[model samples]
Target chain A: MKRLKYILMTLCFSAAGLLQAQESMKSLMDERRENREANYAKWGPTSEHDGMGFIVRAGYVIGGTSPLPLPAEIRKINEFSPKGGFSLGIDGYKYFNMRWGLSAGLRFFMQGMHTGANVKNYGMSIVMGEDIVSGNFTGTDITETRMSGFTIPVMATYRVGARWTFNLGPYFSYWIYRDFDGHVFDGYLREGSPVGQKITISADNPAFYDFSDDMRSCSWGMEFCADFRVREHLNVFGLLDWGLSDVFKDDFQTVTFPMYPIYATLGVAYYY
Target chain B: MRKIFFGLSLAAILGLVSCIQDEPLNAECDIEQAVVVTDDAEAWLLNASEAVQDVPSADTTIVFYLREEFMDENYEGWDRLKDVAINFRLTPGATITPENGSAHDFTQGGVYYHVTSEDGAWQRNYHVMFIPVQPLTVTYDFENFRWESLERYCEWFEYSDQGNEINMWATANPGFAISKSSATPEEFPTIPWENESISGHSVKLETRDTGLFGVMMNMRIAAGNLFIGTFDVANALQDAMAATRFGLPFNKKPLRFEGYYKFKPGEKFQNRTGVIQEGWVDDPDLYAVLYENTDENGQSFTLQGDNVLTHPNIVALARVTDRVHDFDNWTHFDIPFEYYKEIDEERLKTYGYNLSVVFTSSIEGGAFCGAVGSTLLVDEVKVTCEDEDE
Candidate 1:
């Protein structure tokens, strides 16, 4: 037992030394990649072309959102967004030994958000003194809305090391579908009262009416994704997509104001 | 290769250590902060008297201006009016009552011309029947009665001590009386017999000696009489003067009455249609006879006090009777301005800017005789302008 223990201790020490040696190798590789990246940055695209190799990239697409304040009396009903969607893209390694590659692919990302708000139709009667007008009247309809849009990232990639890769470029997408269901002064005023007048409001026109219009259209922006390989041909990465163009053409006319769908995802990628 | 591998391993360890030091030192940026402070204190008064200015009095009369320029194109009948009296035991309440009078206009709404009350709690009310001399302006002399005194007469003495009662209630006084008469004294609700005559005439007070005389008269009307007139200035003035009673000029004239003579000098003494008798006679403890002038141009005009023999104007006082004017179809011919030349222009102007000279039946002596009632129609009766005099 004592001899076995000694053998085990020796094995452990050897393993520790091996790990230290491997760490040193990783640092050397990282330093080499950094030097190459600096050189590339100074001269733009580098000329280090190698044999053709395929890069399978997978990563988290992250997006930041700023909550917009609604109009004076407009109410937000509900928002539909994608909790998370998996993205997969393929890149063709061309030129010198997989050093530079051009990538092209389509990604179907869906974001469904659930949010809602309410608005108050303002009015007054002689019964209530003129001075004491209601700020938030009870007899007003609360507008409910649900928005959804799609994103597809397309770009080119340049690799500095076996694991480190940087991607830069633009993306295109279409808000294939959206639904908004509305009710006029729902549950607000009684049938016969003036306050009970049914009114349906929309984002398409300045006039409030008793109808609805479709809003799904094509909108696009830019994107940047970086991958850090955990091992050969495998990487965990981060991606950011910013909307270059507005989702709503007429943000002011749209009764619900402008809301651009943004997102962030965490995932893995495989490179060949 | 061995040396190279060893060098790489050492560099990797150092790099990891440097990477660990790159974390942010500050982490409190995400916490929320709040602050609160008090607002400034200030006072404000809205729509109060300080915010409004009184309408300045002008020598030029708006009533006369409107009368001439603005005529009611819808006038359908004769210019007729009745002064419906709204009496108050505490304060003499007067305003055009609803009587034959249209709801649209009343002296343009006629008001109770004069209010009389005796020492006793007994009060009497009377309404004047006449035509406007030109939608003559009707304004109450608010200063005439004490504010505290008039307040008691408002409705039933409620709201008597109001702070802004003077100006607030001035708009609804003798010229315009507001009623809160849900409760009223039983006996005082009706017009007194002395003031029952519809004509606008003289009030007779009798006296042996100046002492408390237990006499009273009062008038009350629910609604009905109204005044009608063209918007024409002349017509409005004529309609407004319909309910007015003119006091005789204080002149010493020795007169004799032999047989039945016309009370009026010429033409009809009282309007055949709109005639009213007003005034009364008091006789000490004996019989208090109340006479009204019903006959046009043919009634008596004299009032004798209980002390007629001892009175200064003994003869005139002895032969007093009720008189009414035959005012129908009469022009300004027989009764000229000279008829009442003894009346002081200044005194008449005080009641209003307009003054009308009318024939008066009287004895040579001045005496408090019986009352008289009569109706007279006056038109375009206003202050004589220098241009008109010329």
Candidate 2:
């Protein structure tokens, strides 16, 4: 009988300890909620509580629309320069809770690049009036690429504490203008194939090639972004857009390689 | 925050630099130089310099001329050539059939060497020959012509009395193909005129517009021309003056240049930039030149379009002075070769002189200044030579 009584007392003590632990855990949760509320309130009237808000963003872009794992035909990049480009956009953010949210935005962006590269056996087709001349070139290629477009991004956002947020999703772009032109110099071109008639191209009389018409009209990509709150209504942001579609049309065979438009942007945003 | 930015920048740069990995193998298969290995090269070759030939990028034939004594059927040099070895300097990593520096029987016409590129993606066939220097025929009938390998256009050639085809004529046809690839063989700047000839087929050279591509390249016109020498198409654009390498080694003294021609000029004479020059009348040109084949240093040399008529090495010249403009009927021209230097009899026997005959529809065609549609028809061209025994 005494052993049964002792077992009952031990069970009661265990139940009481469990209740106390549950009470402490509940208080801890309450404290964290309060802290989160206080942190959100510090962002002034721009910060929304389980609702929707708007943001205006402006950014600078400095990256190239290039091929992934560059092809072997491109032997070396002698020089590279990112021409000045910018992005301006407005985004709508809807919050479900303290941590999870959704964002959709439209942006106008422009990107330009100038590069000099050394290549060997690089196949290309140049526009000559109404016709095209196809050849394999081995020499220095100077290229200039420019693209301007309107982009729409839909993303899932996660808020980290009160000052930082991250988002990632798909983006759709429709190009308004595009240009891809270049010159090949200080080399010899085999007209048609590698074993065809050789034509020497000097620096002063380099061959010009333009593939602007071959560029695609629309491209889709993935965008990853981070925003850091600098003030109550202002935030600094960084974004990376990696194109999943090729820059050229499906039937274009001149470049022989698929190129992507991968760009990174750094900017500031104002929330309201 | 600053550290994060720095790290991201560094990562981007590293990613870019790391994309450049190992380079691809060379895709060019070419024989830059060829040399015949012999105990006494001077005894077997026409000139000691003839043993080694620097092959141009645009040429596929590597020819080494043999001494005149080797032409004798019983000469011992024939046996030596049958077992001769030729060494070739090829593009890096390229491989060749028949083995480099291996002996070959060049006496059986010639040997063909096939070179495969380092990447194994391309191959080029080269014809290497060791033959006695043969002179071209005294008369050109313009009746022998055939389509080139690509069948894009027709090219003119001559045949020896031994029934061997000789590539002694060159034109700007190859260069013209670049601009007007859709043109027919008959539409080319140089074509054989069948109905408009004195007797057999005659050569018709006409200046034609190069079209859109020519405009983009700032080369508005291509004047038809026929010359006795090799046309280096590789330099046709940037250095046109150097493209026309004139002359073939001659073993006899030239006496005169004789030919019959019909000429007609286009309506408007235009400059290279397509600017019409008022009151400018287009004129045809016909000339023959003889010059020393070797410089003072004993290196073989040939005249180019820039210096064919004005070079100090010229020994003789025969040019038509009284041109009959707009002659619809065939006009005869017989101009005597004016000798400026005494002929060295011993050098003449050894093929130490070079001869060239050039005819063009436009006099200033090399400068890209000419009238489109200017036409010149030539027939029965002849080069009279002195007797070898004299």
Best DockQ goes to which candidate? 2
**lDDT tens per residue, model 2, A1-272:** 99999999999999999999999999999998787778766752223554578889998876776778788888888988876389999999887876788899999999878889998888876656554567888889998999999999999988876788899999999999999988889988878887777788889887677789899989999998888888988988888888899999998877878888877778889997
Q: For candidate 1, lDDT tens digit of each residue in B323-345? A: 33333432321111212223334
Tell me the spans in candidate 1 whose CA falls farther than 4 Å from its real position.
Answer: A1-84, A91-102, A117-152, A156-162, A180-213, A249-252, B1-390
lDDT by residue (tens digit), candidate 2, B139-213: 888999999888977888888766778888999998888777777788788888998888889999999888876
The clash count of every prediction, one per candidate, is: 95, 0
DockQ for each candidate? 0.01, 0.47
Worst 10 residues of 1 chain A by lDDT: A125-134
Q: Relative to the true structure, how large is the alpha-carbon lDDT of every model?
A: 0.30, 0.85
Task: List, residue by residue over A112-196, the lDDT tens digit for candidate 1.
Answer: 3333334433231111111111112222342333334455566677676545667767777765554433333322211112212
lDDT score at residue A95, model 1, on the 0-100 scale: 40
Q: Which candidate is the best by lDDT?
A: 2
TM-score of the second chain in candidate 2: 0.93
